[model samples]
Target: MPVASPIPLAPVPPMIGGGEMGDLVRDTDWSSTALGDYSSWPASLRTALSLVLNTKGIAALYWGPQQWLLYNDAYGLALGDRHPAAFGRPMPEVLTDIAPVLSPQVAQVLATGDGFSIENLSMMMRRHGKEEETVWTYSFSPVQGESGGYEGVLLLASEMTQQVLADRKRDRAEHERAQALLRLSELNAGLEEEISRRTADRNRLWLLSADIMLRCTFDGVITAVNPAWTDLLGWQESELIGLSLFELIHPDDLAHTQQGASLSADGHAYARFDNRYRHKDGSYRWISWSTQPDEQQINAVGRDFTAERESASALAAAEEALRQSQKLEAIGQLTGGVAHDFNNLLTVIKSSTDLLKRPDLSSERRARYVSAIADTVERAAKVTSQLLAFARRQTLQPTVFAPAENLRALASMIKTLVGAEVELAMDIPEHSHFVIADPSQFDMAIVNMAVNARDAMVGQGRLIIRVGPARRGSEANEQPMMPGDQVVISMTDTGSGIAPLHLGKIFEPFFTTKGVGQGTGLGLSQVFGFAKQSGGEITVDSEVDQGTTFTLYLPQASEPREPRSVEAPHELVHGHGTGVLIVEDNPQVGAFAMHSLTDLGYRPVLAINGQEALAELARDASRFKVVFSDVVLPGMTGIELAHEIRRRYAGLPVVLTSGYSHVLAEKGTDGFELLHKPYSVEQLSRLLCGAMCTHFSRVT
Candidate 1:
């Protein structure tokens, strides 16, 4: 409805060039509208105008010849005490010092016939009598008067010193960026050359390595070969280049080599193949190859195992043949020697007994003859036992004890056996030396050696038994019997020394140089057997007409044991007066023991052997109180018999008697009550009394 009288609008500003405003609105132009009545305004008003419009509070000012009329309170305060006087100053005179320092923007605008301005143009301004520096900016524009005539110039300026400095900093940053870009271009140009140099260096390194290296395509075509690869094959790298790896492989090994290469290519991180490769001279050598795949190529390294492989094969063959020969030699020696010794033993026993049956022998002579026969037979049996021990057929009864004490205990007997003709000496230290060995066997070993030494001295030379601590060094050729210390017992004789040729075989069975009945070559062998079986070693040193020394090294004991003295009565004595059972299969032996017991004032029960003894036991389990039996019986053995008796009579004193101690005393096999064979009336009596005393003492 109001459209009829729609708008008679006020005239718009002249459109010089069409735009949001007009092209005439220059970026550098600063124009202002008067509020009202300029003539009526006072000096105070003028001052306020200078701060807002004349100065650069929010507004800026321009005057003649593009001079800076005034900035603002911000600009004036920066000018300080002479602010108002600084108004309307010529732009050159006002900023003569600062203009030179500004960028070329002002000069450019003036020379180009264009109104130049910037909303945040920055500059540093130094006012008179000021100690600190300040920054500002101005706009340069042509002036026009009301008469439409060209006047001077005008300036619309703002203090933009912080902004101006920031702009200059941006320009410096752009220049630095350009220089950096130029350096980067140069670095990129050298990158390819550096990469090539590193690759060459890596190739040289691979060539120098001990391992043979090769680079190949996925198809097994050799692309590059290191000097190691060429040297190992006795060929040049050029000869291998572009050649298939299969060409170098032995014909029989090609299939496996291909399989490994295929596996490496098929996503296996690495694959290995050991095979024979053909050398340049047409020979095959062992090579262990390891390969890894990378994208489309394969890298491989190999080792030559030919020399080691051939040596191992030869060694294996030699060792196998040697083992067979050693086994056969040992068997042949044992068989041939054992048969001869057994026949000789049989011959001796037969001949000795045959001579004892002469009819002219008187009772005394007959008794002596019978005793000699028994002694010879016993000696023959010992020979067999020693042979068994050498053959490792004899079981040893080992106990942990001091070897020194065992040797010392045998001192008296050794002295007696050596006779008063020879001076027997001992060198034993006072340390607590130990050994895991059979005390009786050890004693016998010492005695046999002493007897040999006595014989060697012709019963008249000095004999020295030396006992000391020793050990094998870490670099020793021989293995130690035990983990630590060893007790050495060496017997030296200053008599007829052994010949060098005879030294090695002195410990061999039946190898004596003496006439028949003078020596049993088993003496030294027995010593050897006892030492070896007891986890020890024996060494003999002898020189012709000089002397001989037999050293026995026994393992040392690990811990301390209660002190014990091996004492036995060798004279006539009384029994325990307790009930004693004498189980003997042999009538003569039994009657002699029975008479001995009667003489000892002890009650005796008679049984044939283990059978009769066990029967008497079944009849009355604990009636007899103490069972004395022989070790080797008719039906059951003595140890078995002890077990049976123990079942019926637990804790009953069972005394085991043996010839040469079948179950050794060291092992504590039977009970503590054991009577060694050929026991005198006194020994039998003492053992019986001791067992009874021990039994009653335990019971009480």
Candidate 2:
């Protein structure tokens, strides 16, 4: 074999002419790269590299298995910081930031021997000193070697960042302009539809409304009238049109109507008033007008409320009649109850008196009869007091006292009243709560409620009396209480609740569900009266078979002054021949008083009326030790007489007495000692002695 002459080495390919990238490629140590030296490079890679280098656009070749980078000056310039150092590096390493996006695309082109192209391909590149967002139109084309196998990938790119941004801006502006125009058109269409709808509605209202609609000039000349005017006033719209609106108004209403018109003329936005308008039959109909003022004109709607007014008047009359009927019925019930109760009391008294008159009666028997009479009289007095309380006409002595303290004091008494079978619990707050009210009446009310609760529970359930501070309207179910701080005393009982049908009438005097002798029914009534008279409200809530709660809200009072210690009861003391002036209108009562005073060892003088008493006093005022007068007199009232006596006789004690006097109840005792009627001999003696003692002390 001819010694194989050393085949001449293949000549090196000419260096690419890509300016800066070309110079870098020529100087690079390509043997160190996977693509090897350019002298051994495949024909296809050399051709691709030549095209990429000389191309004006951005282009690069990723050649061989390693996919080494060979980019043109334009592509190198686009590479920013990566530049010449990237010339001979592997494509994945050189384009590290975009490898994720570029690798798969390049692999696809190489494997399929296909070309891939995309527009606006976004890449984050470290261009300058920092990574920046750039967009480009780029493609990857496969390069084939001499053996017809895919060698690597060729990349061509054109930056689209500025172009794409500008196009998007212009498109956005056009879209916004289109949207604005569309909204404007919609607004115009909607406005037209709204105007048309409103106009149609106005026309329909004018035709169908029952109220008389009219337009008038500020000067009161009618410009237009709707058809309702014809139907309402029996005046045709044509007849009313162009006529002075004031002509149709009743003479009595003309002045106010003109004044209302002037308000509209003065540019008041709205005016509402009631006036009488003339009907076709010469009768006057009441019309309620609501007018709106427009430029130079007033549009008014007049509703004919004549029937409403007439109905209101008729209703009021009927209500008054009903009230009168109810009042009469209540009076009948009260009269019947009082008669029945008093008859029982009088029967005992009459029997006792008849027995005491017997000469053969034993001492003990005579004493028992007299005691029975006295006890019966006391019971009758209590009945009258309850009646007065229920009527809210009882005298009240209001003083500032701690309700909590009072409740605590009465807890034991309440327990006894509720009995051993019923559980009685008191929830009095630790802090003191003060209220201005009659303490005796308050205690009585509580006892009455306790008795009522015990009876409702059949003497065998729970009674909880809770006292706390409250604000008016703080509770949703409570009645409308006066707005202020309030002391709430609530009694809750687990008992058979009151019937709904009876709730409203429970406060009415003599109204009761209890059979004959079981209850007088004045207990709750008295409580109700006391609550109202004390400037407070009482509310009850109950459910059938469940329970009941009676809540009393009293106006809270400021902390009271330290209370003075109560004095012990005084023993019955004789008058010791002291002169007593007795003024009484009733003959029988006056005679009884004189006898009682004399029996108590007092010298007594009688005057039938206040003027007679004054005359007697003028005769010898110093003769009387103390003046005792009945409150209701023929000429001047007892309260008036008391004032006169005080004015005339300084430091002279005048004691006023009454069964029931509106003046005394309303104006109070007027700083004078008062004795309730139906007094016992002992009571009379004690009061007279106390009054005299007080006077003596003052005089001394």
Candidate 3:
């Protein structure tokens, strides 16, 4: 209901009105209205009409119970198609569509005698030949009679439909612009991540290459130098770092190096740039360099191709002169440049294995990093195996399994890892559903996510892991997904949310918000990688100071995968007391191998090299059933030894071991059963027994 202010009635002065409605009011026959004939009208109604008729403001009056409509010319313009027809009719008759809407307001104004006003109130009225939505600002005031009581209501109104519609369109356009900016922001972040990855790869290449390499800022400050600096030039990395690169250059070749350095600083990089640097032993070494520069730093690889013969030196100098004169363009190729991704792969394997050798390193993390080392092999093969591994990231052996069950199994461990401070919650549905993914990787991803959430909450908050059906029609972050029944695994946290600026980069490799060395920034990246690789996607929703939710949408599998059957668990396979020849140069490793083999029911014979093993075999070839050898040996390499044994002993099995070697990178394991060094008794037994069992089966 609406209310209206009181309008004091004044004396009529026995006259008519003025303005456009003056002539109409003077000549109208008001007999049809409830006010009766025009001459019989009361002075109070006439005075109110006289004032309304002469007024400049838009006003209308509803007099008597029948509500006869009277308005000045200003109000008539807003009355669109019903202006003249609405002159004498009742207000309800004139606005047939909106009578219900206006009747209550009119009744309230007359009863309450209090003024009411509203802005942008919606109404549906007949306009443009159809019912159209409208917005209006109007005030209803109660009109008074000569007795000083309420009579009828006064109306003041303005239409705002056009302005409201225009503003809505503008707001929608702005929203679209914001979305576009977000996509652009994401693209820029992706480019930054690519550059960062390339930089890390270049750093690894420089550090591991069998050459002289240095990393420097654009301003000529050397930040890092390869270990070869000490081996080849008799200068420690600490002595050379923080010094200007130009300080060690040969005076004769300084001009040439400076020119190349200048070009690199300006982003023009080329291969085959040659120069000379003075060694700490007072001799000059001829070095060839290839450098690439980004905004922050320069990555340069240099090889010293010193000549032993005078004639060779002259020939090299002539070739270098000709090469420099002919080379004018930079090498724009990116694919052929990652020189030693293999070294990085080997580094990971060696580092993780070394950690595994420690008495206190936990088994879970050892398995995790070792698995990471295996994944690193794909990238290493890209350069050495002539296969594109970076082109096809992560190789997974996916099987259908229920995510809810896996989570439930791991809940106790997760709670322990997150500590007792944070509350853990699970919201899995009662019914069962399954998705296709790697089981080990699935376990690892969840642990990584739980640890990440724990860190985000600073070790105290609610962490929720939920599983349910994905909402198919809703598009998250405007990403398109495969059409299917998708299962979702959602991990939500009641911690500080990600900012808009950081949201676009949270999944990039090596991008982290944690302090240096605290995070690898690969947890969420692996989650995203696995989701996409398994034919699904991941989405994040966050708000500052509130919380975040990370959802993994995976295509639901129609049927559950059959579980693999294991014949024996925790069973040590034993040899049948046949002689096992162990070829190893390290005395400690040889003694350990002898003890382990004897413990496993094999009569072990120890040898220092391949020749000793061959001699042992020749003494009585029938006594030796298997030859175990390390890949790197004193006189003969293990790979060369394997070839020799294959030639001499056709039926003997050769098992080779190494941390990682150039031979393995180039030619691979070459059909021999190979094991990485520092293997556990379990892994060693598994390989040796499997090899022996295979040989026995083949012979029988």
Candidate 4:
């Protein structure tokens, strides 16, 4: 049992020199002050002042109900021009400039008979002769007097003005960066919309360019020239029209121009050819060009590069700009597709929420509506998780575990999900050794492949999950994975196989063969991404009327996995008034947890964020046996908090909960046990109790 240290009505240490403040304290006008004469001061005041004044820390003491102030030399400098004369004055007078910020803290320490701390406390005070912004990390504790009452507040503080300002600066910079990215994204999206809206107008915009733009027949007879031909080459639009394109090119540049034109002859096109065109004055001007062609005519756009001709860098830069434009066009197309999918999901969620608002709904209908909302939410989360995974933004937490054991464990669940008509087969060995991977993601990948297989079989066919070890294998899937000792798991379906035409697109996001509402097209892509991220590879094999199979090859771990301690599920213990800190940002979720914990005979503290939870624990860390926190929380994530707690309090266990988090998905949750969202009260209790019980036994 931890015992509280009593607040003594004495000095913090041995009585000694009071540093520079001692002379001023002795000479102060105490006769006209709250404590009468300085020499006749109470022993508690003298001892406390002496201890505080002698220390190097910025310490101070507020003595008596009047709160007489005293401080060391370190704190005296903080007083600016009022250092010496400020000694022994009532704290209220001395602290008049910062009273609003300091008073509540002092009152809190006195009211609770405990210490109060504020980090980066901001204040606008008359410091250095003007009102200025100041920040500090400060602490105040109640000091007991000779009569054992709350005498004053002991002050311990440090200025954090610079650090606070620096942090604000960084936050502003990050905000700006985010805004810039958002603007870029919006602009990219708008560009796509504009292009789609003006496809026909775009041809006119290109044809009437400031640089030369023209159309010609297959035999090179010029059909049209924009105003740019007249502006640059001193030729009327009518004069340029009906002439052969070869007549416009300078004699020395004709060969190169023909080479470019020849390439565009068979409905193929080429770009970045440099040549010269004849001006009306007979001089030649250099031009760099791009051409597009078809069976009837060829279209060309050119920009004058005469002045920049000596520098090849300019030509290269122009080519790069053209390439970038094409890339953005492709990206815009992808974004449009993603937006369509997301909007469909939002429609379902929005309609469900609006329906739930109707008070006349029946319980069964309400339940169905709620289930619809949950399903859509889960689907949305999975889609986002897969997107993050493909972008390599998800964190992976890898552990060494035998693939064979887990495959067997998931056999029943997989069978249930695939339905009764499908015959399930497992070819897993008793022990295929261990492999390193995120077990959760690995399980998800397996499930995704199995579901795809089940669907391919139309709910009625042979689905086989085979696990084994191999040194080398055929790369039927064409993925380039490292070749060495490996653990391979294959999910095979005995149904109509994928056609050759669809093979390349099977792993593309949003490319699904399932009917309109049946699939999200992220499953295979997620599997592919996960395999690649784990230093493994996934491949597919299929033939029409035959079967389809997805094989995942993972590098084998060098060491064997240690078996877990076996505990009977029925023997799980219950909490006996165990103190738990529940850190959840959602009020409904927090209230439910608190109520559930109370019913289970546990003392639960509800904190809406990681900071509040830390403050509660800091007050009396030993009172809490466990911390249950949402993975995504304000200020600090559950994963980060768990790390901090493990550092500060070794014996404490943290149970992190999340429905879906990019951080958790990318950076695997290790050390801390994860509790997925939508968990039951019974599940929470068992996890909390099991962790506490296991850790307690380990400590003993």
Top model by TM-score, which number?
Answer: 2
lDDT of each: 0.68, 0.84, 0.76, 0.80
Error of 4 at 111 (Å): 99
RMSD of each: 23.5, 12.0, 23.6, 36.2
Worst 10 residues of 3 by lDDT: 1-10
Candidate 4 lDDT, 288-332, residue by residue in tens? 878888778898888998888757878899899999998797578
Flag clash pairs in model 4.
394-666, 395-666, 395-667, 396-666, 396-668, 397-668
Please tell me which model should have the higher TM-score, number 2 or number 3: 2
Candidate 2 whole-model C-alpha lDDT, 0 to 1:
0.84
Identify the superior model by lDDT, candidate 2 or candidate 4: 2
* Global CA lDDT computed for model 4: 0.80
Residue 472 lDDT, candidate 2, scale 0-100 = 41
Residue by residue across 223-331, what tens digits does model 1's lDDT show?
Answer: 9888876677788988889998788788888888788778778867555568998889999989877877888888888889999999999999999999999879867
lDDT of 3 by residue, 544-571 (tens): 8788888888878876557666444334
- Which is the leading candidate under lDDT? 2
Rank order by lDDT, top first? 2, 4, 3, 1
Q: What is the lDDT of residue 50 in candidate 1?
A: 35
TM-score of each: 0.43, 0.68, 0.35, 0.44
Q: Note the residue pairs that clash in candidate 3.
A: 4-114, 4-115, 5-115
